[model samples]
Target chain A: MVAFIGQLGRNVIHAIAKLGDASIFAVSTLRLLFATPWQGKHFVMQLYAVGVGSLIIIIITGAFTGMVLALQGYHMLVKVGTEALLGSAVALSLIRELGPVLAALMFVGRAGSSITAEIGIMRVTEQMDALEMMAVNPQARVMLTRIVACAIALPLLVGIFDVVGLAAGYLVGVEMLGVNSGVYIGETIDKIALTDVYAGLTKSMYFGLLVGIICTYMGQRATPTTEGVAKATTQAVMICSVMVLVLDYIITSFYL
Target chain B: MIKTKGLTKTYGNVAALNDINLHIKGGEVTVILGGSGSGKTTLLRLLAGLESPTSGSIMFSGEDLAKISRKRLYELRLRVGMLFQYSALLNSLTVYENVAFPLREHTDLDKEVIHTMVTMKLEQVGLRGFEEMMPSQLSGGMAKRVAFARALAMDPQVVFFDEPTSGLDPISAGVISSLIHETTVKTRMTSVVVTHDVQAGLDIADHVILLWQGEIIAEGKSNTIKNSDDPRVQQFIEGRPNGPIPFSRSQTAYVDDLTHKPGCVRLE
Candidate 1:
């Protein structure tokens, strides 16, 4: 029992140490944001990889989610004889909660995993060492560019997801289900404030930063092996997904 | 010039490289030769500042690499180049872009001048007219040559090669060995190569450092290493199975293991 407790204590210490290292790595990369000789080309490339590459999945997921929400919400509001509230329900649910959370989760599955795998492969193949030998700071040239790109891309992606979701909800609630189109549009516009949009975007921004830092940290710390790369990719997706949901709850609680 | 004083690198309880001193001269090819688990690559990484030492110092022209600031280390790294064992060419970039990468990053050279320089370096490595090819499209030897071209792109004063001929056929290995020799001589750059290939080491090396069990067992001119009297060096160079160097790492007595019955006590 004593040995078990001692082992548990050691494991806790190790975890804390790893967390501290990751924090330092994140702060150092953030410091490089204003450093001279910015990596404009690399940043642009990463924007294409993380943002544009993720557009199709986000669109498909967002459209389906909004349509389903409209259907369920209409059924519920009809029982209460307040079917006009369907638009307000769908729009509020999406812009305030579902939009940023689902978008970030999808981003984790797609872009975040890819980023981790790419950096992990580079680590295994000694390309990171090669960059260091060339006097290029991998943290600045590689990690910072990808992190900043994700931060910029996530908000834009969330905006697209929210817009598409609203459009899908309109199609389902008004055109398909014969909820009065004017009432639907008017209620949705009246119910959603600019503060809700800001709140969702704020959630997306934090999710992006968290995913970027976690994925890059895991990749950089991965052992130089094939198994290591695979494990890091899996962990990046899992951890980022959990973090996005946990942070979403925390941020939503504060907002409320 | 590069020098080390009591340089050591340990991971947990295992020492990848132990306390050692070495002097590598400028403008010559130095070969670090050892079989598997001999710490040759660890020493090469230490010299390139890719890995820091645990206990001692690596001096590059009197500047201790372990003590330098990150900014200064970056400045120092700009003067050095390394060809990794697998070439490690950027998979996303074409050969032309790969060779031109360092130049574009470190210099203000115009595109026309950069193109000319990259072409010249590729031509030197006999990789001319293959500029548009991606790394995935190239063969192992071709990839290595492209990496070599990139390594020389910045006119670095020192270059490190880690197992330059590991995966090549004999003829391709000879080609790479010859290129290492010619490039070192023609460019007059300090060169450090880590390899287990005895013949390749003999072909290009002016100085030879033989490592065994994380320590330098012998150091001398290449010809002197070939004629070394040290039992470990002799066994390694001669490729002999029975010698002072143990073939197996097993601690149990070999004869007893072979002769004894499974679950039976040995009779005196």
Candidate 2:
């Protein structure tokens, strides 16, 4: 039991060291960000790939989730003679918690895993070393692009999620659930101030940056072995997922 | 010119390289010969600044590598090109894009100039018209030639080859060796190749250094190596099993064990 405690302490220290290393990586990433124009093209392309590619899923999931929340909230509120408060409940959940966090989590799994695998394979195959030899900074072109792309992309994705989710809730509550259309739409509009929407967007931005930086760092440091790329890809996805959840909690407590 | 002093690299308790001191001059093809565990790749990586030496200094044109910033190191790297043993071509890029990659990154050259240079390099390596093919589509020799063309794309002053001719047929190997000779003459470049192919070294090297047990045991020009009196050198060049380096058994131990069989347990 003592040995186990010691091992756990050692592991915690190692993790803290890794986090410190990650902070240094962010510095290098900043250097890469300012150094090359290749980063511009790469950033735009990765943004398009991550944001546009995931558009359908984000919209569908947002719409259905909103509809289900509205249906349930209205039905439950009617039993308590407070069905008119349904709009605030759906809008609150969508803006304060669900929209940005869920969308960011989904993008991490989709975009972050691919970036990790691609970069890991590049490292193992010596393409990264070849880039260094060629006087081309791989970090600038690869990592910076992904980070900036995600920073731009995740907010836009969250906007899509927010508006689509709101629209879906409005439709279900007004047209299908027999709530007065004007009251449902007006109450939602009144409850969702700029602060709510902007806060969600801000959370999305942080999540996007987090996902890109962590995934790229893991990929670049992958071991040069046959299984290393696969392992990096898996670890990137797992870590990004957990980080998105944790950040969601922190942002929710702060913002909401 | 490149030089290393007391270059040592240790992995935990194991010394991959031990106090290696060497000088390589301009306009020479120096081959470093060694087996798998002999630290040839580690030496190259240390000089290339991909890995730092545990203790030593690497000086290129009198510039201390440790003192230079990464940007300056990158500038220095523009003068050095390395072709990996596996021909590390970017899979997503075609041969043309791969070769043109360095030029595009480092130079202000427009697309027209890059195209012209890429074509010229491909033609130099006799890989013309394969520019559109991906690295996965190329044969091993073809891939190696493509890698060579990419290395030559920047017209680097010093080129390093990590087993450039590893998987090629004899004919292709000859082409590559001659191409190295031709490119070096055409560009007056310094070339360093690490390989265990003794015949290839003999055929192309202006100078050769043999690495054993993390140290250089022999070094000379090709002709000097062939006629050298050192027994280990002779054993290596002649591909002999019996010499200073025993094949599978030490001579004293083998004789003693032979004499001390159960029937003749008392050799004395």
Strongest candidate by lDDT: 1
- List candidate 2 segments past 4 Å from native: A31-38, B169-171, B229-231, B238-268
What's the TM-score of candidate 2 when only chain A is evaluated? 0.93
Candidate 2 clash pair list: none
Report the C-alpha lDDT of model 1 over A1-256, residue by residue, as the tens digit. 9999999999999999998999999999999999747788899999999999999999999999899999999998999899998899999999999999999999999999999999999988888998999989999988999999999899999999999999999999999999999999999999999999999999899999999999999999988899999999998899899989899989999999
Runs off by more than 4 Å, candidate 1: B253-268
The local lDDT score (0 to 100) that residue B173 gets in candidate 2 is 84
Instruction: For all candidates, state DockQ relative to the true structure.
Output: 0.85, 0.61
Per-residue lDDT of candidate 2, residues B114-155 (tens digit):
999999999988989898999999998898999999999988
* Poorest lDDT segment (10 consecutive residues) of candidate 1 chain A: A33-42
lDDT of 1 by residue, B238-268 (tens): 8998899888889998779865969867767
lDDT of 2 by residue, A1-256 (tens): 9999999999999999999998899887877655655555667788887778888888988898899999999889999988787788899889878898888877887788888988898888888888888877778877788778888888998899878988899889888888887777678877878898888889899999999898899898888776988898898899999999998888778864
* Native RMSD of candidate 2 (Å): 4.6
